[model samples]
Target: MHCSVPYPADHPFPIENLPYGVFSTAQDPEPRPGVAIGDCILDLAALTRTPLFAESPVPAPVFAEVRRAGSRESVSNLDAFVALERSSWRAFRRFLHGILSREEPLGDDVLVPRTSPETQMHMPITIGDYTDFYASYEHAFNCGSLIRGADKAMQPNWRHLPVAYHGRASSVVVSGTDFHRPSGQILASPGDSQPIFSPCKRLDYELEMGFVSGCFCLSIGAQARLTWHHMQIYGGKATQLGQRLSPQQAQEHIFGVVLLNDWSARDIQTWEYVPLGPFLSKNFCTTISPWIVSMDALEPFGVGQYAHEPALLPYLEHDGGVNYDVDLTVEIKADDDEYHVVSRSSMKHMYYTLGQMLAHHSTTGCSMRPGDLLGTGTLSAPRPDGLGSLLEKSKLGREPFGLGSRKDMTFLRDGDSVRLTGSARGKGYTIGFGHCEGTLLPALPLLD
Candidate 1:
């Protein structure tokens, strides 16, 4: 499908892939919802003001409500849009695909040049809660083997469930934001009796993908059988607080996917992550791409789930293509200002699928909210070149990889910048998460 809006054939956003985000132009300073269509953002706010949605099979009010709820503040967040019924989501995506594929060119009023200096992208969703999962078998095995030896690489419970930990939603930021290198307690040497408080000596980046959760439909017994649209309008009939979700039910809860960079301070993590999991090592900053590629758009690129040794529990078992074959790459920029591709991986390497991760999360009746995030941990591959993080590529800093001019490179430097990008290729099109990137700043001095 060709888009009337002119762009390269390989452009990440096309008529087939209308990823949503919040953007503001200099002329229009208020952030508003938009979808990237061939290098330009199709202004949803402007489209809503027009009569575009009048002919849609889905009620115009449904689309209007999402826009109104999301566009209320200075920085428009897609939380309200995420909370909409799944049917509305499908209708909206189809409507967008229909218009952009038309032969007639769209007007400037409804299109903003994405690369223009004035077009500013912001965090698409106001995340309520975040969970980071260790779901990659290769990544888990690599890290475990490096730390505890190959004999104990596979944790006893690793094959059973998708292991995860609650993450800090407050520190979740949009792409292009800079963050300081974290300072925390770490062992100065292997034999050190006590840990020393200092700036992180081993700073790293994790290449991962995250899925945003959609609406929370209250299960009102038989009334739950009501049409999703009517149930959305009536706000449902029950006040059930905690309810378990099967793998099939959990599939509908996912809104979209984005590239995620879970920055890590390895030294801090090594020192602190003992009885409990990662704390200060991870909570500092986690970056995500602005655009969210809808689950509908990703359906074309679906692939079979990775092989699981032990049979999955009934709740986590699902047939068909649960994982996506999105190609992921990590790059680092040094003083020269040119990005060097460091690692190449794929989401297909993930042992646990996003559906399984979400299903396991809510299996205990934990209430999940709209705009909640679930990260797929480090997506390392079996090959050495496909390692996701520097810790793995560098073998815990013992073997430093070579970059231009700087041969000894293991961890991130003060001025080094890391960028992560992902895309799934299709017949003459691409579905991509724009860019998840951030620069490292110098750490602050210790307390006096």
Candidate 2:
């Protein structure tokens, strides 16, 4: 994976990095799938026509369906699209790498007309359901101490399993989509005599990563049955062998990682999440950057799992192997102000890996799908500088930390914008999920 020629040194897409996505030009009638290489998009559909791709391991029908499905459309549902069983994915990557080599022909036919960066990248997949998991120990402890008193912070089972709750997927939007502030009922005080209904006051963003399942698991038995049947009938073991994934296999199931910002309304959450859990405070709008960075691209950065003392159930148990080495950081910017890095953390802080979460989630035989998203709850480090949310950084709005412009933030205020960026560094290149950002608009004017 060495290259002699450079691609301007700063382009998001270099010959060494070919992230895939669907895009379209104003002149083009519809969106088509392509790979980013240098300043151009390697039109996959066009490339499929070349003799080079004739023997590609990727099923021909998959490319045809992509062209037929049109560009800028959801590619998540297309069955064969993400089914690059490990071997196929590796082969395709090598094929593309060879073609994009500096010595390869850099002629007009090989490149497609470039599309504007401003062009929309539709939701990569139609998310069926979203589950946010509290896997980061620092984030859990920090937020727990604020609401549950310092001594009685995390729940007894917090360290044992991947704690999560189902979230509304319909409200999840692709990046660049503006979200309207949500109106909800809240208690004026913890022991208030009455509840007040109003738009949320403390809206905030959560920085997290997500993983997608590859083959749909009807049931643990179903997967087992399929593997056995394939081996018996085809006289060949299933390509994706082995039950229960290692940290590496867990990465393979990841279609791609995205910068997810789970918008929150602390005022509403505080009042509602007593006996039940977050309801109105959370379900408003969540945004994710459009591109899905394949897990294969992030393999170079896999790291050791976070330490844990709690014992696990038989179903949830593994080698305690979970986590990634991706470095994550958040930036906040007020109106017309310079952005400042507020926190720095790594996915390695997570108590449970995505594999453990999936195994635990489906232990009850619940079905899992390709586009379903599992949010690795806010990744926070142990120190204050690594804090992930405003609630923790500002001591629940009681303390004010000064930003460079004399601007102090207790929590997000109207017109404040937040951005999250992440990357997995490699030998000669970097894999990045651009940015997930959103600005808080003023609440709708009160009605007379």
Candidate 3:
């Protein structure tokens, strides 16, 4: 866990923390996947040239093919690549550590130029399924009070389990992608009048964390024969043949973690979410940071599970179950150029751990794949300023919070930008998910 040489003090990546992602040099023909360390991108293609990679158990042919295929496009499909066994990935990281740790001549050939500021990063995977879960206790309680009375804040099941809904994965985009204002039907009052179609009046962002699924094998004939397979198989040649049969060995299918922003329309959600759940209000758009911080990299940050009140279901139970101790924060910038820390919370606040969520997701025997995504919905804090969304912070637009220049605010307006950041603190190195950011653009004019 210790690195021999120090990366630049402020560098996002260090040898101790090699977070992987897709990147391309300014002069390169296309983007290729690489690992970040000390301000430089460790070119996987170039790193493959060394003898270190030749000795590893990773199928060299498959590795070479994935690297080549990924290099051709602006973003590499890391989902298929990282699912390889821990041993293979460990060997690769160890090889990289030895080479990138020093300024040795052997390392020079593998090093891509220190040009991150000039280069662009793309989404590391092609997300196939997206599910957003209400896991944060503070967020649920606070928002619950807004709709329901203070005494009746949280639902009975809120303290017991993780509540989630399926979201549209097609709408998920990488950071830096612009989101258009959604036009939806809104009702002024419930059961009072007909709804009107108009541009979203209250556009907001939900600060969240997301973990990608590893891989699961599903049997063709049997319903209960589904099993979890180690991720390493995903990068092998057999994957092309789809060896993921139900009777085969199944393992935890966890790819990594990424910062996520679930853009929401409060006005639309309030009217739509009742007997059914979020529809157009949340489906319009979602964004995620590019880097995928592997679960192996976050081993040091794992902590005990969130406190539970009622007896849990057997499906959600596990031995030595726990959640990650990741520190999360959200920042907001107003039109006047002032930045404010809106909320600070930890992943430990989640009522359900990723393991429980995944287990619950599959309890009904639903098939999961390499690129599926599960969002930890709105991680909020207990204090007033620690709220995650504008709806909770502004008390559902009933009370206003001061932002220096502006005397009042309900939700995001044009020119308002929000950013989400998360990191796991280690002895000397910090593993981080680079910012998931977006700016609110003006809603398009409506036709009469």
Q: What TM-score, computed on C-alpha atoms, does each candidate reach?
A: 0.94, 0.85, 0.86
Q: Which stretches of candidate 1 lie over 4 Å from their true place?
A: 54-56, 67-75, 218-240, 446-448
Rank the models by TM-score, top first: 1, 3, 2
Residue 420 displacement in candidate 2 (angstroms): 0.8
Q: Which prediction has more favorable TM-score, 1 or 2?
A: 1
Q: Write the per-residue lDDT of candidate 2 for residues 8-60, one digit (tens) a residue.
A: 55454565556666655655546566666655667766676676666555555
Q: Candidate 3, TM-score vs. the true structure?
A: 0.86
Question: In candidate 1, what are the lDDT values of residues 1-448, reduced to their tens digit?
Answer: 8678988888898788889898888998888888898779988878766666555665564666655744463235576677676887888777787777788888988888999999999988777689999999999999999999999999999999999988898999999999999999999998886999899999999999999988756453332322433234333322134566677777877899999999999999998888899999999999999999999999988888977888887778876637899999999999688899999999988788888888889877666666779999999989978999999999999998787777899899999999999989999888888989999999987669
**lDDT scores of the candidates, listed in order:** 0.84, 0.68, 0.72
| TM-score computed on alpha carbons, candidate 1 | 0.94
- Candidate 3 lDDT at 61 equals 37
Count of clashing residue pairs in every prediction: 0, 2, 15
Cα RMSD, model 1: 3.6
Q: Which stretches of candidate 3 lie above 4 Å from their native place?
A: 1-6, 9-11, 50-75, 102-109, 113-117, 189-192, 217-251, 445-448
Winner on lDDT (1 vs 3) = 1
Deviating ranges (above 4 Å) for candidate 2: 2-17, 49-51, 55-80, 105-118, 189-191, 217-252, 445-448
Is candidate 1 or 2 superior in lDDT?
1
